[model samples]
Target: MLLLNGDEVRKAFPVTEAYRVVAEVMRRYSAGDVVQPVRTVLGPGCDGSLFAAMPCHVTGESDSGYGLKAVLHAPGNTNRDLPTHVGVVVVFDPETGQPLAMMEGAAVTALRTAAASAVATDALALPDAGDLALIGAGTQARSHLLALREIRRLRRVRLWNRGNARAKEFLQWARTHTDIDIERMNSPAEALCGADLVCTTVDTTEPLVSAKDLAEGAHVNAVGSSVPGKRELSADAVASCSAFVDSREGAQRESSELAAPIEQGLLPADRPLPEIGEVLLGRHPGRSGTSERTLYKSLGMAAQDVASGFAIVQSAQRLGIGTMTDFTG
Candidate 1:
């Protein structure tokens, strides 16, 4: 078995390559080529934090392996100066059901999440999108900026965070690493206005972006609300836009951003909710009108982890990274 720590996994999965892998994953998903069971969670009390287990397998793809990931979310840890999220992924032999390797899940999660957003943007956003707005200055926010830059020729970036210090820090980092002009915004509305692509990565239960603030032909990717009762987009925001999700069932049950609007009749029940994969497969048209508003709500998925992990494992093997050991007893 091969054991890959977070650092090793990070080295193996480059942000640019992740975009390609995730785009292919979306195509497969739209074509119904993968099995992704809904992620199951437990906790908040006796178990210490919210815990989730996700399992997936790729159809007709040998050596890709069946993948299982266990994730724990401990928000209190942030206050204690520790990571709020932690987890691991186990890849198993397809024919024997034997464990083949163990890998860090946090890195996998971040890359897969950002890559999924890139796929959505590539499909839904205009080809000439140049200005980008990012809400929040955390790890996911950084990853989103990097992943999107690979797909678009971003010219300007507007950043907003509840903390001015964090926003300033991220601005400095962006200026040092990217040639794009970076500006700090005092409000979400100010940051969102006139932006071609808007990405929300903050953990906010209330609406942050509204319909009135968005411009025509804008594409919004809401990535923060992955569970019940947490919302970031207002009903007006959802109503004024054509929406798509990584998964329809996931958006219905887990995405408060989309669900809230659906419950209020802001969005039509008959409105076509196509999967990102379907868009990638060219089965459904994306961004039908150049002036239409489009939104992609991501709830995260295990199939993404499996597909991304497969990419990392292959890269690791080629580069001779990771610790290899025989787990056969």
Candidate 2:
């Protein structure tokens, strides 16, 4: 068994490499090459935090295997100097059922989530899109900024967080990571103003981005609030866009961004609007017009972590990065 920590996971899987694997994973999932169930989330209840078990199998690939990711979402972890997401992914040989590897999942989740959003944005956002608006000030927000840089040549960045001090702290953090000019905004609307690309990473139970505040032809990555109870985008914002999702089955039931409007019959409840995988596979044309709004509701999947974790372990092995423990017969 190979044990990898968060830093090792991030070191082995760069955003660009993560992007490549995620693009392949989504294509495989939507094409029926992978088998996974909707994750089972058990909440702390008192704090609305939850833990989940996501297991999946991937076939017809060099990394074919059964993968399991046990994840904990601790909303209060930031206050305790811990990651909001903490987990481990274990991969086993499909034929022999022998364990292959184990790696940290928080870094895997952050990079893969950001990469998935970048894939959608690259497919749907207008070719000329430049400016960026990042909502929320946590790990996802920071990772999205790094991942999106691979897709868009960002001209300006506007950031807004409910915690003004935290947003300012993120701004200072950004200064050390990249040379990009980022302005901390006072409000979500102010951050959204004239932004061509938007990534919402806030933890909210209600709508935050309004349709009226969105710029013409803007592309949105509705990333936070993965479960049924939490939401980030307004129903009007959902209605205004050509919506896309990571998984049709998962999004239809689990995406807070899409669930309400879909349940109210304002948006399609019978099926998801269309998947980013479909767009990636060229089964559908994304963004019908330059002036059209586009939204991608991202619900994190087990297959994503598994596929990404598998790739990360492979990368680490090639680089001799992790502790090689012997689980010998």
Specify the highest-lDDT model's number.
2
Candidate 2 residue-wise lDDT, 1-329, digit = tens: 77788889998999999888888888888888889998888986899578899889876565557899898888788899887788888988567777778888877889999999989899999998989999999889999999999988999999989987778789899999999989988899999999999999987887888899899999999998888888888887888888999888898768767767776677775643788888888888888898999998999878788888788888998888888777775
lDDT of 1 by residue, 1-329 (tens): 88999889889999988888877777776677778878898875764578999998866453355898899888888779777789998888677887877898988888989989998999999999978989889878888998999999998888889987778788888889777778888999999999989999987788899998898999999998688777778989988988999988667767778767768987666667888888878788888889999999988888788877878888999999999888985
Give TM per candidate: 0.94, 0.95
TM value for model 1: 0.94
- Model 1 has how many clashing residue pairs? 1
* Model 2 CA deviation exceeding 4 Å by range: none
The lDDT per prediction is 0.85, 0.86
Model 2 TM:
0.95
Which portions of model 1 show Cα errors greater than 4 Å?
Answer: 45-48, 60-63
Whole-structure CA lDDT of model 1: 0.85
